[model samples]
Target chain A: MTNRWIVLMVLLPLLTGVLSTPIVARLRLSRVLGVVGLSATLIAGLLLLNNATSEQAGGILVSQMGGWAAPYGISLVFDTFSGLMLCAAAAVTLCGYVAALGTLDRTVERRYFHPLMHFMLAGVNLSFLTGDLFNLFVAFEIMLMASYGLLCLAGGEAQLRQAYKYVLLNLLASALFVIAAGLVYGMFGTLNLADLMRIVRETSEQGEALPTGFTAVSVVLLTVFGLKAAIFPLWFWLPDAYPTMPVPLLAVFGGVLTKVGVYVIARTFPPIFAAGEAAEVIVPILLTAAALTMVLGAIMAVAYRRLRAVLCMFVIVGVGFALAGVAVGGETGLAGAAFYMTQSMIVAALSFLVCGQIENRVGSDDIDDAGQFSWYRAAPWLAVVGFVLAMTLVGLPPLSGFYGKLWVVQAAFTGPDETPGHSVWWLGLAGLVAGTITLLAALRWWTGVFWLGREDQTEEPPATQPASTGPRSLTLAVALLLAASLWMGVAAEPVLALAKDAGTNLADPQRYITAVLQPETTEPSYASTHGTTTPANDQAHRASPSTPEHHAQDSTPPATHADDRFGPNHPIRLRGGH
Target chain B: MTAVLAICVAVTFAVSVYLLLGRELKAVAMGVFLISHAANLSILAMSGSPILPTPDPELGITKRPPISDYDFDGALRHGDIAAPLDVMVDPLPQALILTAIVIGFAVMGFVLTLLVATSRKVQTLDVDELATGEKRHDPVERPAADGTVQGGAA
Candidate 1:
């Protein structure tokens, strides 16, 4: 029953968005719907988390759509990692929505804002929960589409241009995604992730080589995900586009979209491609990319004068951490990556919210132009909250941020095939240095905005007048996020435990595959050879000269090969072999 | 087939670079579209050629075609007619290209709208001119006032 509501937790927001579109003209009702739907989703997410914790030993709890099992129907798995992401997404969207509600003009509110926000939340939720690769693509589109709407909601010239680029880049990514999905489907004859895992393993064991087809698919998938995740070469468009959205929308986008891409990459890598030498090559490249991303993002953050732009840079930093963590590719690395992602999301969102507050008070986000508002005197509580969140972002001790970094550093140093000597050590050191630079950058920005005293009188008054009183609701929303960040930082044990469990699940993907595949009363014959002999042989075969011919032969529909691969009463073997 | 994709990719890459360097916003957008198409084509090429139909042995064709008679895959396979398209074009890249095309269209549309809005609001399409940074406070501010304000020294 609780699991049932978990699915609804995501669906409710989307449903409300769709249902309320007709009545969007009624601003009050749209507001009501947005709050109610998101609030309910938040509660549902919390409830799901509690249920998951209580039943931690129960393994992964799966809710299959339409009551069909794996390979036949779509499955939504609720594990510790996904559950945590779901809760974080729900919390961020809820807080961002509440914050924007108080300050968003009624006209803007009525014009698709509420619906889009809800849809964005729904998309984020779906991205976290879906067990199908194609479904992940769909979730991405849902989120991107909503983001497009949200990005250009203000209809400013600059925003429109930026939004265009954002939309275009993402659309290209989606297209690549579909093609990748089709390729994967063609190779394995299955779109279900669990089924793919089984098939990949079996093919390798059957002494069948990996087809060039799979390699092409893997590269394309990586490129698409890289574009979305904002890896160094592909990240130029993000800083430009993200800062243009309204602060609240920016906060959510900053926190969620790219992380969704990271999650996909993380989820898919160890399970499907762990055995491939390609993963080995890819990891080093990813590490290099991570280093570039970190240095570039930090430098850009320092260069930017706009508060929102600086926060956007931090988003890149977070992505870099996730990339580095993933590139390390072990239990500890994955845990650290997961922990870092969660912490980064919280901190990034808080920073954006604070930036929004400053923007409201100063009537500008430009650091040089923004005069200190005596916010400590004017909005003391908000200032305190903002300061705490900033400290968390800087990874000061006792905060969630510090723990996340610690986990990643520990993973980097202690992981099983630890890279010897200075290379991994340097990478780890670079990460630490990046973290320190980010901290200093945040501190510098904070000092300028909060503690520098008002700018000299010679500076021109900002073109727009500041709002007399910061919106009460907005303040409360920031306070809520601040409190949550601090609380997560202070009482880090439980969440860290959950993160650890999530990381473990991610690292050891057999449980994930089993949870989804659900070896029932009728055991699958192919299941036995999946992780063992077949996958390795298949990988070798793929690398060998006869791959093209073998792939052509293997591409034959499963219906034709199933009987030969596994006799009757041996469904698992058949499933695994094909 | 590879040659065709290669040419397309090269041409598109050049055009994209040229357009990206251009000052006109429209050219930039069009450049992006072209580059994306080029990328799509490149992906298709990378997937290799599709499996060609097996030649009819009865049609006066030998069991093993001569070196000159076969396509790339056949040439590689040493005229083995039995090899079902060993290099059948990977459908994944094609699928990916298709997705890229659709996304390109959506992005293009959004960008077009933005271009039009920017031109109207800023009253100047030149990015350099717009960089003067005269803040336009209201959505409904008159175009003339904006022009005068930025055009004037103060």
Candidate 2:
């Protein structure tokens, strides 16, 4: 199949979401429609992944919009990394919706809840697909706007108060993002990622030094993404703003919102700017922040007596692991980061859904309310689910979380060199300490909520027993997510392979650049599918006089120079000449 | 000209940051708006001095400036391009700033509505009071008969 159709993954949700408001209030079939929309997006994502990893596509797919080729027009890039993230995010949101069907309050559901959810999903998918920096900013605004509405929907005064902080902080980040994009455009003269990569590559090849403000621009970009990802010092807005949302919304927020930040970081860094002093400055700072985020997140989780608070803190901890893995910046490290990121999204959302189930049963998420009660006697299935979730969060063996964390630590200790370095060992050490503390916290949580009164209450129903078993749909949703997590653990080869492909593609961006800039040359199949190019135009493009540098650098050819599209061949002037 | 723009952006940012740190919700909301404006201004400054096209007397038509010919140093090299860089102001930054402004406006509208609703429900616009959750506890604040605390204290 041609890859241009991958844009439908975004269009489907956007159309469905915009239409959901009328369908819900009038026909009352929004639930079914929401399920169908999300499932379709998931299938499209899976298909995109298959096409991206297939031999014909060469691990990357680029679709230019409005026939305005690269550097001048917007492009939608669907690489292995985007495909994997797209699939994970779609699956998590689908499950969250199903869970919400059983758990959402009727008033909220009537107040355009499903529409907002779908709108948020559309923004997320677009963020993953967009190849331009400005487009990413627009996507972020879409997502954040939907999130603001969702956070305050059906909220009392407290939730609205929290929403104020959430909106303002994100507004600040959005403003910073605009400034950063402008700076990048001023320096590089292009907002397209692949074009930026080409420029950065050519300048370094010509032995030209980057500008002095390069590091500052990099820091601003990092700060924008860091605030979104909730990295160390920028994470203060998360813990308070998140818990005020309804459970299903919180589940989606915990799942993909922060992951989007990590996604951009992994996509931008290493691939575009990993060659020089910028890497030297940014990598160490990233590692330090990762280590600090890990230790502090785990500590906060341990200190919180509430289940949702603990879950929220674990989301931060997962961010730390994923960031560390990305900062390591090699095939192994990036692959590990991608793997851990996908796993954490699923695991975190599932844990939140389970917490929602607990809350529905007991009317509160406070651990003290459980009060030395053993859920084993009251609700065996819930006890089992909660136990598995806690174990996964603590990164125990044979679970999905353990595999990803193991790879990250392995990448850290091995470092990029032949021998391990003393510098990055502290990151691994921090992960270990945090893991141990998480285990302690998980034990405390599990015993207090699920295993404490086992001996004394044997076969005796307690006075404060849980209400009637919650809806079957909620159980089904939890079970589906659990099965997905377990499947990832037991059969991790396919996912790991996809992640490795993504890492390989990221480590060497030439294929991506060519696929984007000159699709016909890189992937001939693309030309056959979309017959917009002519042989006469191709000749003129190659023989254009504006690219004298390509002819000058003939002695030592770069790898991408096999095709004349590589190097400092001006794309716009060439196209204009034709 | 660029230096003046730089100073203007700096001052705008300073004012926004100060307002952002204030205790009033309305001030914070305005701070967000000013910050967005400053960001837009910085982006507009990236275009440098704008040059309006003039009709050429000989050709009887205005010449369109060529697109950028910039290297990594952000310096223009006019060797390859047909027209000199001075005649063309890069339009991409203006496009970006436009998009940012529209999104900022939508966000500001939402922020205003949220602030109004929050202050009405909580009965105070003070950010510190909102954060304390004290408003939720005492939704109505009537001063004591002894007049120790003023009504609607800032």
Candidate 3:
């Protein structure tokens, strides 16, 4: 019963958003509808997570759309990993939406903001659930389209002028995505992730060399997702593009968007590509990029004078730490990555919301004017919240952020196994140094804003125009996020346990493939038919061209040499292409 | 035929990248438009040769030999006669191409509107000029009527 409603996790919000737009406009129920739709989706995701974690479901729940089975139809597979991601995305977005209710301009709120946000959430949910590679591409498009609108909705001339670079960079990534998907389809004869995993696993299991194109194709896919994730070489567009967004939207974007890319990388790397030869090439490059992203991002965060700019750089640093955990590659490392990502999302959202409240009080986000007003006198609780959040972001102990960093650093130093060469000590060192720099930067920003007492406080009027008792809704939103982060910190044991389960499931691809295919009941399966021996060896299969499976499907003659053009023999398989 | 299509895709992609790197907003918009087409074309190529214009007069579409039936087994496949189903005119890539085209069109429309509005406001279509204009027009840097800087940028 729960399995059947998995698709609704995406469809409900989509329908609510599309159908209620005009209705809500007249009745002024956009906010109500948005809240109802997202809360429902969040509940559904939580239920799905419960189902996925249960013993009977075996950590995965598969829902084939339109009664189609396995590779032939698009399936929505909900595993522990995706379920966790879905919950985090929904929770943060809900916070952002509620915050927007208190903060956004009336005009911007009235102008399709609810619908667009719901639409983006629907996309995010679909991306996490979809089991097919092409479906992932579609999901990315849906998300990106909504984001472009949101970026410019409440912004001014500065935003309009800078919007092109963001659009163009995403457009480039999308184009590359298409090219990569097309190539994968051409070579693999299927776009279903489970089927691709099966092919890679079986080919490697049979001890036959996979075509070299697999590495190139995987690298290309990484580059595409990497650009989305805002890692080192590809992250240049993010800091420039993000600072101009409305604070509420920034909270959501900062929390969710780049993490989607991280989620995809975590999902794909361990299960599908790692089983093959690609891991050897991918791991070093991934670690190197992760190291660079961490150090460079922290440096820039310190260098930037503006609050938004510094926050933007910290987002990159968070991405780097998550990626470093993933590059470490074993169950422990992936568990660390998953835990860190969830923590990062919550912390990022909380930090931005706190900053937004500060901006409201101070009249600007520039740090140079920090000493002119004492935040402690204006709103004591907000100042305290900001200080705590700053501590969390810098990875002070007993905070949610610290545990994630500890796990990643431990994994990087100790290697996932007893293997000596696998330990990423330098990456771990880079993470530590970056953490220290981040601390300095966070303390600098915090003290300047909260601790500094104005020398002529009695003489000059307060710069804060808004009453100290501003909208309660604003504080409610911030408190919600801050509470969630604190809960995560205090209750790290169970969360880390869940993350470990997700990692365990991901590290073993066979579990994912079997759960999706359900090979025992499904007709003889693709593996049974084509995977008798050296699966792609054309010469061996040529003698028995029309397998029984082909006959079973239809009275169809097998395409001569069609199998030869795929797998290891395809022309795209250039030696030493990397 | 595949080689020809590959070359066409490569050229389109290279040209789009060049346009994308240029300073003019119009050129960048053109690049965005061209890159989508290039992406669409590359995906289309995966479906098999997209019935391109051939230089050889004998191999023209009207004069080209019709797809014939050839079967090693006593079986006929669905669209199997069209040079085997998967190898020639795979519908999946066509479906992919169609989706890409529609998405590309929508994005291009939005981008054009944004660029046009930006260009009009800044009174320049060149990105470099727009950027300089932005610095000049920034409210944060602008001085008030009484000679005090706005936005508390001390």
Candidate 4:
């Protein structure tokens, strides 16, 4: 089937939430709608993953919005990377939903929690799929808006306190994202990723020098994404904001939300700018950032007492691993990054779930206090599942994370031969050592939570313990995630191959352009598919260049670069070209 | 015109950053608002001036709208291989800023809500006195060495 159907993945959640918000508000039917929407998103996500991974499709799916060729209207491209994220997002959201049934208080439920969660999904799905910078900004806002709402859903003093910082930091980041998008659009006269790739390649091939602000723009974009990903210098906001969230929401926040930023950087950086004129400087800067982020996550993981705080630190570790792959820039590194990012999304969310579970059974998230209650005393099977996920986080063998780290290490060993600046050995070692620290931390978390007998359980009873009442859904959700992760581990080869396919495709831009801007895709009458065109030469189209923002009349306008008159190479000289 | 806008953008950005660094939450929120607008102005300035074509000697207008180069009607369909004329201003930036404006408004509303809720809860809008995390409760022993230890507030 044509990739047109992938739009459903975004629309289903968005439309459901948009349409049902009022109904849910009036009737309080959030549970029913949330379940239905989440289940459908999961089913669609799995289907997209299956479709993308299928060999015949080669794991690349592209859909141009409004039947307009790409580089003009927004486009949605779901390669193996995004497809994998979709599945992970769906699983995490589903788990969060199930767990929410037990964890959320009446206040949280009465608020627009369900609609907002779906809105968050919509934003996330769009960010993963959108091929336009403006669309990405919009998606970020949607997601951030939803997150701010959800963070304050319970309306506690502390939650609002932390939520303020979180919202402020993200709002700043959003403003910067716009500035970056504006700079890029103003510089290149195009916002589509594939088109940007094409323009960057064309200009560089002609030996054209980069414009003055080019590197600044690139760094700014990276900075914006870095702030989101919690990489090194910019990660201070994460631990502060994430811990105040209720557990189910925290699961989604740590698991899939932050990865969206990393995904954008990974998708854009290597392909569009890595080989561009300023790349000589860009590569080293990114490598240093990745390395420092890795070390910081590991060191801080050992320093934090709160379970959520430590896991948030590991979220940083996951960012480092994924970026380490991007920094290395080889096929193996990129593939490994993709694999590691996908696995971490699942493991991160599930790990948070397990931690919350342990907190419930025991008294607190602190390690010293957790020793009193063993899985032997609380729940033995949960202990087994937690151990497995923890080992996965530590990159233990036979789990999906191990293979991902292996690829990153192997790639780092050789480095990118094409570029001398990307040796990245110590950087990769940071990732490895970070994994070791993570193992030690996991041991601490496990030992502190499950190794000791009942005599040690003398800490004050946790606030939520009285209310938990042994809800089976939290257990079932963690187990389901564990089982999904186990399947991922067992099926590592296929997943790795899928990641490799995505990495190769990302490293190559021509295929992306063809997929996006091709005149005749699937059928020749695609223009008419828009049904609003009054012949391509309708004089009305001319008037809109003078005012195209409201130029919504043309349903299937030509790609933005079709003129190329305003592009850097052939800039439209105001007084006519000399 | 472009130069004037660039200056405006620079000034706005400076003022926004100044506001953002203030101790008052409301000032910081206003700073974020100004900075977002500054970006919009930067985008506008960078798209460059709307260079009108020299008026035809006999046509007697600043620029003729129905002129050949300005005509896009025949451009798309006939594959009119004509090079683009820089007669009209770029409208894309306007569109982008319009989108940004709406999204920004939504986020700004959210930020205000959070700020309001925070002040209501903490009983103050002062950044330092707001006191976040258990760290403020007991900063001395909060970073407790090794992996697992607890203290009041942190």
Candidate 5:
């Protein structure tokens, strides 16, 4: 039952989008369908999370799509790690959708906005669930396709301009993705991570040296992910491209999109490419980039006057903290990074949501002019919400943000309890400095707007505008998210435990590989039972070339030996080459 | 043969980059289109010398080599789905590139429409001329008697 539901979790949004677009137009039920579709996704994801996270379920669940084995076809897996991401994504989508109902105008609503959003959620869910590399690429495309529409839908000349640039950058990234996938396929003869692991293991057993191209492949993949994750040097596009989006849309992109890139890095680094010769060099480079990113974000944040710009800078700082854990590359690093990501995803979205509300109540998004809103007289609760959110983001204790930072800061200082790497201290230093800067900037902005008196208080012209209170859905959504963040802060133990389990799972990729690649059976499992030895290598007698057990990989595909990167080996006698 | 394919990819991508640097939105759109096709071509080149001018060149055509068969053996390359080793050209990259092409076209269409709409609404297509957000800039243009901004572009 869970197996079938796993596929449905990824498919439901897409199906809803495809089926309901015309219906939404005819019935004008876009809002209703959007809310219903996303709520269902959230519930389904929670159920899946329960199954994946339970002690009896062994922390991993996988479903093979189309009855084909993973090395042969796509597989969707749910582990504590992916399960955590799914839950966060579901929450963000629902909240973002509700917030969107308040923000999007009636005209914009007519333009397939809800359907596009649903499609984007489907893509986000698929990206998390997919076990195949090509499928991951497909997932990225699905998300980007929807995002391209959403980003440009409210097209001012300025927004359309930035949207074009963003599209161009992503197009290049997509090209690079294809080239990387093609190369990986040519060399390894498989895009399935688990299958590749089996091939690598068996090949290494014969005492063969790992190919250097594998390292290059990893670097290419990282570069693509870096563009999305907004690491230093490649991050310039994000701050510009994302800040211009509509506030409701910004809340989601600001919070969740970059995290998706980080999530992919978290997934691919350990399970798929961790053992590669490149892992050693790559991890250090990642740490250096993370450190540089935090410094840059902290400095640039103060330079920006706009509310969203400063918030976007904080988003980068959060990314740096998460990547720090990736650099650490052990149990402590993984656990701390996961916690930091979940916290940032919620708090960042919350900040944007509150900021949008304030900006609407006030006149502008600029921190200076935005301070003109008399919070004491008008919208007192919003001011308080903003103050609390600011405090939470600054890492004040008893807030959700503080816990993640503590774990990450601790990891930075201690490294591992057993062995500390040279990079750990630097990571710690950057984390500490960034945390302080973030707190200072966020508090400064909050106080300037809320605590400080409104501009021209003597005039006392009440809000002449029709109240910013558009719908109960808006208030409901904001209150629900704020309460959820508070709940996470107050009751941190269970979630922390779950994050730690996910971290431990990441530390051991073999467990994930076995759970994904193994076939269904009454017994415990093949990968789990024979996980210690290269069981597939020993059980050659039972498996055929196309066996569901193994993709009977005896030889490296002959294509990679082509003298040039693009050329395939052994040109067909008379007709070889598509 | 590798030389020919490599040169073509490099030239296509290089030209696209040059076009992308232009101030005009149309050029930007063209740059995206050319670059995407370049990417599609490079993918085909990597897939073992399939010289089809377009995706599925063999589809609906009679006089062509037989399509390759998949074995799905773990030993096979590219997603563990094995194409017959004896096949002249691998069809998988073609399939992948075809998908990329269709996706690219859809995205390109959307971008072009956005470009036109923004130009029509803002009365300019110059990238530098349009810096989003009304409050960010303070251009002192006088309004017409009808309360339109002189030109009635919006």
Candidate 6:
């Protein structure tokens, strides 16, 4: 039953993508299909979450396409972390889809917008669930291709320019990803992530060192993923590109894209890259990056005149939180980061929706222009909801964002004692300062846009104009997100528990390794009938001769190299062979 | 062989930088293309030279000879043929570069279309001119009351 739902989650969106062309003539039907498809995904996610905590030993549930085994066939794995991410992604996409249904122009809607949106959601789901590296690449491509269509759905000059830059940057990242995957495959002769993890662990243990070529490849991969996550120096393009989209589209993009990159980095770093002495070196570097990203993002937010642009800056703050957690490099840090990310996604979506409402009411997103209008008088609900979300962004106590940050701070303080001299502590201090600065920045914007009256008096429009009515659908969407944010903050314990489970699962590789390595002896009906084995089974059979101990030994020299490059106590190990 | 690839990459990089810094839109587009090619070449170089001997047929193991074994004549011959066959040149990078190139072309085309459309509608390609007239107005504002009689005084 679980497998059936998993398959449905992937297939529904793909089916929508395929049927979109023929259905393009019928915009209403397409919209209905999109909503139904996403609704199904949301249902599947809920079911998966229930299954996750049902004492069923919720390791990754591997589903082979044609019963073909690893090193050859493709497979999808639904682990707890991925399941939770998918649930969030599905919920967010569903809301965005519904919100967009009322706002999209009929002409644009008929041009396959709904289907493309569903397909993109599908790609995101697949990317999260897949256990193979190459499959992850394919999922990204699918998502990117769909994004291209959505970005240009309105086809204006600004949209074209922004989308072009967005596509170009992502293309580079994707290229780098493929190059990295290729190098890994050429070296390891397999693309199954689980298989690669085992091989990497074993190879590092054996004194047979990974070639410098592969290490270079790893750096390239990290760079690409880093760009996607919009960490520090790589974040310049995002603020410009994201705000150019229509509100609902921006909401979904804000909720999902960067987080997917963060997910990949978080999932792979511990087991594959930071496995050895390098863990000591790599953690600090990540910590510094996180601190810089948070600080810079807040500073930029204070400078932005547009509400959407400011929210885009906050997306960088979310990235900082995720990186901070990874930099902290322990269970507490990971759980905090995961919980923070979940909270950010909800808050970001709500913020974007509120921005859309403001834009709708005031006829602009510019702080100066929006200030002329009385939003509180024009749309009281929007003003109230926006204020709540703004507080969430600033990490107010009793909000999910605050708890998330608290956890991260706690994790940082309690980090490994061996690396006492590491600068993670300094980075943590910077983050705390940055967090306070961000709160001030948010408050400043709120005051400017809502509280303070415009100095330059302009004739106010008649109150009877009704402030654009702000599509009932969009209001509903914003309310949904606002409620979720409140719920996440108030009912935080269960979600934190889930995040803790996910963090523990990530730290302990034994269950994941075993599930992927050992096939059921019963020779399941699907395997025999399809005339192929599961990818995991093939991986287990074609195991490398080297053991984990050998790889651990081989990782020593590079670990020293990394330690030398980044001080001995640096949290992050740059060149350590993991 | 790696040296030759490296030089090619360096030249591409230089040309890209030169074009990118130029004022014209076309030059920037061309620069993007050049930089993409340079990146692709760099990836190829990082894969190492194909001139190195192929693996022993039985064991599928390639052997690296002493530096003295590589003289100019051997280098030229290896650089010529081995560049293509002896080494794989990292097929992954090649595939990635190809995708990047295609995406670059698509973006360039879209930008060109935007430029053309904007120029036709606004009568100028200058950024200052474009920014000054950013507001969306009705199409009816295009002509005067007499249709052809505009404010132009020749």
User: What Cα-based lDDT does every candidate model obtain?
Assistant: 0.69, 0.77, 0.76, 0.74, 0.72, 0.68
Number of the candidate with higher lDDT, 4 or 6:
4
Q: What are the per-residue Cα lDDT tens digits for candidate 4 across A1-578? A: 24888998899889878876887655346677777888898898888888876767656788878976566678898877888878788889889878877777766676888788899999999999898988998888888888888877877666665666778888888888888887787666578887677667655654555555778888888888888888888988788777767788888989988899889988889877566766887788888888888877888888887777888898898899888888888778888888888899989988888877777775567766666554564467767876787788888888867888888877877786546665667877877777788888877767666665465556645565544424787878887888878888987777777888877776666666556654334554534667554323222332123244433433444324332233322221211222
Query: lDDT tens string, model 6, A1-578?
Result: 12535666788778877777688878777777777788888898878777756775464566666766543556677777787788888888888887887776778777678778878988888988887887787788778778877877776545544444566567557656755775565455456777666756655554345444655666677778788789988888788677767888889989888888888887877777555444555555577778899888988888887788888889898889878887776777787778888888778888887887777766667787777776555666655676787789988898878877887777777673335563357666877887888888788778777777554556776565445747888888887888888999999888888888777767666566666655454545454568765443344334533356534644454322221222211111111111
Judge candidate 5 at residue B70 and give its lDDT. Answer: 41
Of models 2 and 4, which has the larger lDDT? Answer: 2
For model 5, residues A1-578, the per-residue Cα lDDT tens digits are: 13657877778898789876887565357677777888888888888878776676788888878865566567888887787888887788789889888667767766778788888888988998888888888899899889988887776544655676677778778877877887776666467766666555544443444554778878888998888888887888877777777777887887788988988888887655655576687877887888888877877776777777788888898898888887766777788888888888888888877877766666456687667656776688887888889878877888888877787777767764436444378778888888888878887788877877655667654557436644566677778789878988999887798789888877667677667666545645455676743433322322222344333343435333233222121111111111
Best by lDDT: 2
Runs of candidate 1 with Cα error greater than 4 angstroms are A1-5, A201-208, A416-423, A454-469, A519-578, B1-119, B122-154
Off by over 4 Å in 5: A26-28, A198-207, A421-423, A454-456, A466-470, A522-578, B48-85, B131-154
Q: Write the per-residue lDDT of candidate 3 for residues B77-107, one digit (tens) a residue.
A: 5532223332333467778888888888898
How does the DockQ of candidate 1 come out? 0.12
Provide the DockQ value for model 4: 0.25
State each model's TM-score restricted to chain B. Answer: 0.63, 0.63, 0.61, 0.61, 0.61, 0.54
Off by over 4 Å in 3: A519-578, B48-88, B134-154
Candidate 6 TM-score, true structure as reference: 0.79
Error of 1 at A52 (Å): 3.1
Tell me how far the alpha carbon of residue B59 in candidate 1 is from the true structure, in angstroms, after superposition.
30
Docking tier of model 6: it is incorrect
The full ranking of all candidates by TM-score, starting with the best, is 2, 3, 4, 5, 6, 1
- Winner on lDDT between 1 and 5 is 5
* Candidate 3 TM-score, C-alpha based: 0.86
Q: Candidate 3: how large is its RMSD?
A: 7.4
Question: TM-score of the B chain in model 2?
Answer: 0.63
Candidates sorted by lDDT, descending order?
2, 3, 4, 5, 1, 6
Cα lDDT tens digits for candidate 2, A217-238: 8888899999999999899878
The per-model DockQ list reads 0.12, 0.25, 0.25, 0.25, 0.20, 0.10
Maximum-TM-score candidate: 2
